[model samples]
Target: MSRHALGPEIHAQGTRFHVHSPDADRLWLCLFDAEDRETRLPMARDGKHAWSLDVPGAGEGTRYGIRVDGAYDPGAGLWFDPDKLLLDPYAAAIDRAFVYDPALAAPRGEGADTAPLMPKGVVTAPLPPVAAAPPLFRPGGLIYEVQVRGFTMLHPDIPETQRGTIAALGHPAVIDHLRRLHVSAVELMPVNAWIDERHLGPLGLRNAWGYNPVGWFALDPRLAPGGMAELRGAVAALHEAGIGVILDMVYNHDGESDAWGPTLSLRGLDARSYFRHEPDGRLINDMGTGNSIDCNHPLTQRLILDSLRHFVSAAGVDGFRFDLAPALGRLPTGFDPEAPLLQAMRADPLLSDRILIAEPWDIGPGGYQLGRFDEGWLEWNDRYRDDLRRFWRGDRCTLGSLATRLAGSSDIFGEGSRTRTVNFLAAHDGFTLADVTAYAHRHNEANGEQNRDGHGENFSWNNGVEGASANPAIQAARRRDIKALLGTLFCSRGTIMLTAGDEFGRSQQGNNNAYAQDNAIGWVDWTGRDREMEAYAFALAALRASQPDLQDVGWLTPGDVEWLDEQGQPLTVAQWEDPDRRCLAMRFRRSGLAIFVNGDDRPRSFGGVSVPARTVLPIPADQATA
Candidate 1:
């Protein structure tokens, strides 16, 4: 059987189910009816390490699962138990979403049949493929990172029935917001089928972010009740609005976490073949998840490629943002830039032109592979996030660093002709722009870990009082700091990213790691938004979009850009080395656009431009090129 053909294939005659299990002693295909009655049939060995069975008259709408029988040897990495019904890795749809249950994790024969506790794969007929088109997005464009459910859940304009679903993204209000921000694309966080971590249940929390996935092709029913059709419609609407869609995919690990997790999928099918393990049989924790996918394995590669193609052809997404992307290139020797999987993706005709972005790091050895991916890829630049935050927070010795980031980080990207940096002030995992200026430390006591679950050093500071201060003076200072940060981000080179709700002063109450707070803490509060800040962000975006010089991804050269001091002359060596200095002007000689920055507490004038304290001033368009 073909590698990509491991899933069920339907024809007029019947449906043929194919499963790859090289080590199973036996295998069976279990079919169920509307009443939840099951009929099990033995599968005949098809090839060297696979099984197959043909059921006549069975076609779309069939609910089924696979049962693998093998010696339960944990030390040898063989975990097969027929009692645990497993989901097909290629399942496009499941009857229901997965929920945590202790019975699902019981050892072989120790627990009752798990079929009652697992979701059954539903057979689906393929939808008409979306007509391919060139992606509307490109390097140097703005990407809006969106948490589908969190972003739409509490949106007042969206009807309550459709509020939290993928369909709600197509609502007029949502599109209007993206348009105002001049977003080139919306990066939807993981919408694939996933199970919450076992620990979250006891704490009365659930995973709001869909990072822990089980089936690659299965769209989480909670997010899209209408299945792939819902995603297709949303993508079509976004495309109509001239905005592309980018799905964030997690291929590093499955929800079958650690040794104590459930066996809902790959682990029950073929553990050794599906996961990376040591010679002694322990699973590798490269992704910080219980186990990492064996990307080097051909079977794993086939599933990943098929999943990507499915979204592109079936749902019309422009591209994908890989979570913990180093896992895609990890091999037995180490992380190789030319790893087979990465090479295959670039070489594949279906995905070659689609935008490929890498998170660029994981918890594994040599995992921080910044600027290591090939020229076809763009990477998330955390260095840009930190150094800029420090500079705007009045840190010493940040003037030079600020210049470097604004010039697209020549030190990191090697001063290339074009940069692959995705600049940002804050992301989904950290403090919001408002929180960054209002909290010196994290307030994650609500996570039930006593504030130990989030980052200890966030490079943050409270303007005067930490979190929710009613002092009018303090509020004014916080607003100034946020505007300064936004100015720095919009003025920076290369592709930029802004997390959802950061523009309108959304806050997680200093909960940097609110992955489990699926409630108001994680949702974007549309009602409490600041109109002034929102308008400021929109104006910044308009300015950035209108300025051709700012959109260029290439490194700014001495002939194209000039750095000036308060005297309106080129910055002297001493001034460049002055750690206390916080005022300078970056003049784009080509377009004569000058961005004057004042990082000090006192207002200052640069070359006769009176810039307020902690503000970035862009010379008016009328006199910019004069």
Candidate 2:
């Protein structure tokens, strides 16, 4: 069962406000004026789980927050405190971004009124919904993962003022770059309003990624100075350029972190229903983010569904990439692909045909569900990422693993008629492609964690020297490896991802987990980018875009394709199991298109074609034999 619509509603005479707080005894509508004067109005209980009020004069641009008073037992998970002014979860816009303050997390009755410290939601008059259209993104196309501020912060062409904002992506330079890469969509990482984690402030660092979101619908004012308008305009521009926009959504958890974390939005209103809890009454941290949203709950499900629809109908975003997606499917027993919320998204009229991608893992038990999602959802295949890296790094027995990945990991997704894998060499969370070949380990000491943060086993290696090397020979070798990685990715059989600056040889020095270094280390250095690497990436994308065989989206069998050795002869069972095998040629029997890979230390010859060391070469002709 659904409750009445939440959030503020603007009418000709006045604005009506509604909220869902089934456990709250009373709720106050806290309205703030231009001079920051506060006015509180009591809301009447409408039905089972709603509290609403109508103000005759309160209309557009009215800044408001919710204050709920109820049981204050933290152990029981009821965190209602009237002093904690909360933003409406459905707040489509906010006056400013949230800043982390210790007072916001002070337990009930300990801290002074937090109204002054928190940002107030700005009431917005809904714009005409963006005209409905099908998503521009499709399977087997490039999904360029992007961090809005970091991606364009250092671009010389963008104006100084708009350099780090979302609107900068709409500029001609950005679109031209996307067009060159043949990007199907740009996945904007967490653009919603977020607060710096409490620990980051003391370290003189902040959350560079907006993963710690507070409100679901409101855009972070830092990324979008003009609020929803900024996002809407950018989406329109990208759509005009034949590119899609996919927002990286975080519904698994809210920024209102742990038991000691802030009482921002969901916590103060209805923590019991919004967040999952154990029998002893502790917050469940399946997402490893302190608190997990109880996505199975009807109220929580409704809130998430409304937010997804809001982005689609109001802002015209093409799709979403769910973060820590296992949390979205977890039931009381375990994660289920057919969980109610997951099914609801596919069945919902507004989202049925939308592009849905899942990160497919978390920190909880049974969280590593690689190919478990239903047929409609494409999953980020870490197997492909790791296998390809191992093969290129000269790991033994990786040739067969590389072949399995190139053929769309049928062993993983054999049940489906087509593969639902999103293959990639590197992503935003790890080392960039350039760093993958140049740094053997993570140097995230700049993150203020004493190099203690980030993954230890990266499966990365230095070509000859670690970090930045002045040796031209070392630099040239790294470039060759990067191009080889790009070639393998583009020639693979499923949809692929290229972290925004990865194609152009962006290096974080050696920082893999750069979620805090918002300075030069995190920003893409456009001026220093390798033009040759950029050209190679563009050419590979063009090839993938032009060829139908690479985009077949089906599982390749022996009849459909053949694997050959360096001499271009069919591989024997013994050769297939050889640990030192370094060359592979996969030819589509129907299209007669072959991709020759040379992972060895020296050049390898395939028929008349000579493939350089650490490279992948494509022969488009029907001459299948050497």
Candidate 3:
């Protein structure tokens, strides 16, 4: 049995509340009535640094919070104020919306009572029956990374009331798109209860991406008005359609920002125990999100593990893509693959067989831990993403690098067990596929950061023009590059992830970091979508599914795959390093693929050569031919 089943547990008689606060001298359970009046009950401390209380009338749907009384010193990392109501760390449902107010964080002892404005944790009943489905996504499966809110925000098929909600993902039109693309998993972005960043509120913006998580167990009411049942139904629908759901999780950090940030949840309950801090009490900002969670702490580890179990057992999610996962494996000594949390997850019964992926790096020391996780864990291969982009952009000495990535990136993931690379060209973090070919530079002025928010160098080529161009020649060239990039991605060994709108040539106008722009800039415009480009994507998916070599789950043995130059001969070291070579061919079993990228402004071609029957389609082939 898990040690930390801390939350509001309902029974036939009443409900019992369990909370962890080792540093608190006294704890009180605050219950809110329908008219907003508060009733306080003293809680008893248990032997294992926990507080417990039982109320006879408190059953399901009771709104409550906790207030711990202890030292209110920030330098020593003891922040306990009874004035500011604290949310349960394991809250399954939040009754109201969370609005960031600076006054809620006023230096511990100086802040006014914030219970009137604070949201309370609701005692939720057990969720609906979670279908016992086997894991649908695997090592070589294709994952479609999408945001529940932004994915169908502007879709014409979704009803206005259901648009931008988790229920919208189950609409027939959305499922049809996934089926067409042969997507095995839908990696839904953060749906956890989160708050808009404090800075964003001042800047007249909001956190469009739910990376700033607040409550670990509850679903954001804004995204899931119907609560866990709504999300479970959506997951059931996707499961019925043979698609798995991989949630993008943010346990690395919380919505609580810096020392001056809001005292919403963890910071108010037990800041010293919940968050990592320096000796003098300053936060460890490894996540680049103001504060890094104390992932290695015993209590924190149990909280995270329990949350994983709750999602899998109650909501029926297939897997999780951990954002900033390096923080989870980091300890005071350094990053250890054998970290307790990592080892526990690997050994756990509920999570052992599920898909676990890592965006395997943070902004801390030794943070660039790409391919450093355990064998069972898959990592987002940024090396594969960058090298593929640079090769198609005609960068010098890229043929050898491209070949390495095409063959499951043995350089990064190592040899035999390296086939778990999550290969991708574009993700939610950077520019879209169409924007990569249409704009060479990032245009993020819309983010109110003076066009300085996103990555400086995109490894992109604009086909001679900087932005959108009217010339037919440039458009044709850009479209050809798009096809070439998609060809390499599908043909690569290992798992492949496609961003939501990239299949049909969606553009962000060059706003790579549209994490703040929730309006037209971030939403996927289904109206007037590029049907031709979409068809091409469908064809590539079909081809990948049909080809066994492309979906190979192990490192290719010596004779399994061969790389060739444009002349249909084995690639020489000299030719591989040649800057002038922009064309390469790959042969696997009976099927062969040839990619010709004209990154240069003028036309370029290679001598005609005959290949095997399972041949490469013409660049930008007709949908019928495809």
Of 2 and 3, the candidate ranking higher by TM-score: 2
- lDDT per residue (tens digit) for residues 431-473 in model 2: 9889999999899988888998887877889987899999999
Q: What local lDDT does model 2 show for residue 364? A: 81
- Comparing 2 and 3 on lDDT, the stronger one: 2
User: Can you give the lDDT of residue 485 in candidate 2?
Assistant: 92
Clashes of each: 1, 0, 0
lDDT of 3 at 373: 89
lDDT of 3 by residue, 1-626 (tens): 22645898888899988988888899999999999899999999866588888889798889998898998887787888888899998889988778888877787667788897788999999875465666888779799999889889999999999999999999999999999999999999999999888777778898788989999899999899999999998998998899999999998899988887888888877787789998878998877788989988888888899888889989899999999888988988889877999999989988888889999888899897887888688899888888888877767755677678878887777754432689999999999988888888999988888887889988887879988888998888777777777877887887899999888888888899999988888989999678898998998898788766767656565487666665557878787788766556666644544333333444434346433221233222122122
Q: Model 1 segments beyond 4 Å from truth?
A: 1-4, 415-419, 624-626
| Candidate 2: stretches off by over 4 Å | 416-419, 622-626
Model 3 clash pairs are: none
Q: Give the distance in Å from residue 250's predicted Cα in candidate 1 to where it truly belongs.
A: 0.5
Residue-level lDDT for 428 in candidate 3: 94
